[model samples]
Target: MINDEDERFNSELDEWRKLPVFKQALVILHLVEHIIEGIHLDDPHPSTHYKLRLYERYTRQMMENALLIPSEIATADSTDLYDHKMENATIIRKAAKEIIADSKGLQASGYKEAEYLELLYDAVEEFRPLFAEWVQSFSTKNFIIDRWGLFNPPGVSYDDPVDTMSFDSKSFLRDLEDDWDDGDDDDLI
Candidate 1:
């Protein structure tokens, strides 16, 4: 038996889930920004650890989604699909950089905010290059169909099927192995 507020919140979450991946990433970025702002404002109840955890979770999600964009672009069936994926990729990258810059600014102030900003800076530094690599991997591709034909070309089937690229969760987890060493396990919550 859920209350009205809980039901409404769940309904909203369902709608939110339906949004495009980049939009979802933007929402997470905004959430991270808001949480940092709250910390700056000296909100007493949530504590630094709680806020840092939330920031980390949102940043991680954004990074993971951004990192997968190149594979998505590479596998797109049409130019329109590739263009859409590229647009989303650009948005996610810019948003990520913005968040990183914001965290850096906070860190530079030499105040209490620097402590939490350091956590964010560390997380962003660890994940930011992966997103950049994904973007770079796609930039050299010839997406214009009019200028050039498909990599497979029409009526040219190959003996070996090309494998579709996907997000590798194992590799992602391995990259973050150090962060998980603390065994805090609050991420399960």
Candidate 2:
């Protein structure tokens, strides 16, 4: 009995697995960079801790995917691919540093923290077009567009609601215990 969230994640993973290895690496790197940027924005907002935790989880997952890319692309090696991979690593590192520095600066500015975060958000929004242009110069543009659905398919709203309703953790754990007690390992899969 898979839930909607599980199904959605499975679908995303399936799509991710279909990408060329290099594209898969780029997508994960891009997602990590974006998550780092988002984490910076949410760091000062206490009310956004849940969102921050989600970003951290995503970053960890992206890092795992990146670490797995070597095996995925074991047979594919070219000068161009090597250069692109090196360039992407450099870019991701630099972006992460910049985001961190910006967040630190905002924190130290003596301005109200929320106000500073709002300003930082505005700055990012203003520069989004330039960021898009920079992204277009990379091999990742198509991969990003495809994975993120930058262009909507029919009947899918960009503002689609996410499933956020929570369930009791204890109940879920008890159900798992009951399944195991019944000698049913099927649910473990």
Candidate 3:
């Protein structure tokens, strides 16, 4: 049977792939892959090892974060879509920053040259404006009040009173029962 999470992921993946920010994220991934191809840790120096490890970790994170963006986008429910989107945007931006920083670390250690790493940096630089535009498009209307100090929409705070709404368990169960009752008996057989 098809599950809701899978269905949501599939739908969001298609829409996300069409987004310019998503496309640029793919480009950054590609550049990361290409750059890593030339990175080597054969040197015996411990600092070189550390720098190479940091570069590897950040690049891997970039790939993982890019893949996670769609799932994060799909996780929106009745009250937290904006938070998820903002969180994912922060993830993307942090990945870009880490990639650039670690690449410089590698350059300082002579594992990779700044000139060659410039391409990867440039791709991430290009992704920034696209990411900003995508973030600006998120609406505050769909959000729940964030109790944590983080991820709240602008001018909102953790100290603000929680929303007074409460879930009606009886009504929710009634709806679920109605859905089950409406199912064709033949489907169970």
Best by TM-score: 3
Ranking by TM-score: 3, 1, 2
Winner on lDDT (2 vs 3): 3
lDDT of each: 0.47, 0.44, 0.65
- Show model 1 residue runs off by greater than 4 Å: 1-80, 108-111, 133-189
Candidate 1, residues 107-187: lDDT per residue as tens digits?
A: 443235555555555555544565555444443233222222333223333332333222344666887896577565654
lDDT tens digits by residue: candidate 2, 18-122: 434444345444544454455454356775675555545544544554444433333222212322433444454344345445454534432234553544445
**Each model's TM-score, in the order given?**
0.34, 0.24, 0.69
Off by over 4 Å in 2: 1-24, 27-31, 42-45, 75-189
Q: Provide the RMSD of all predictions against the true structure, rounded to 1 decimal.
A: 18.3, 17.7, 4.7
- Lowest-lDDT window of 10 residues in candidate 2? 138-147
List the lowest-lDDT window of 10 residues for candidate 3: 71-80
- The order by descending lDDT is 3, 1, 2
Highest-lDDT candidate: 3
Clashes of 3: 0
- After superposition, the stretches of candidate 3 with alpha carbons farther than 4 Å from their true spots are 1-12, 40-80, 164-189
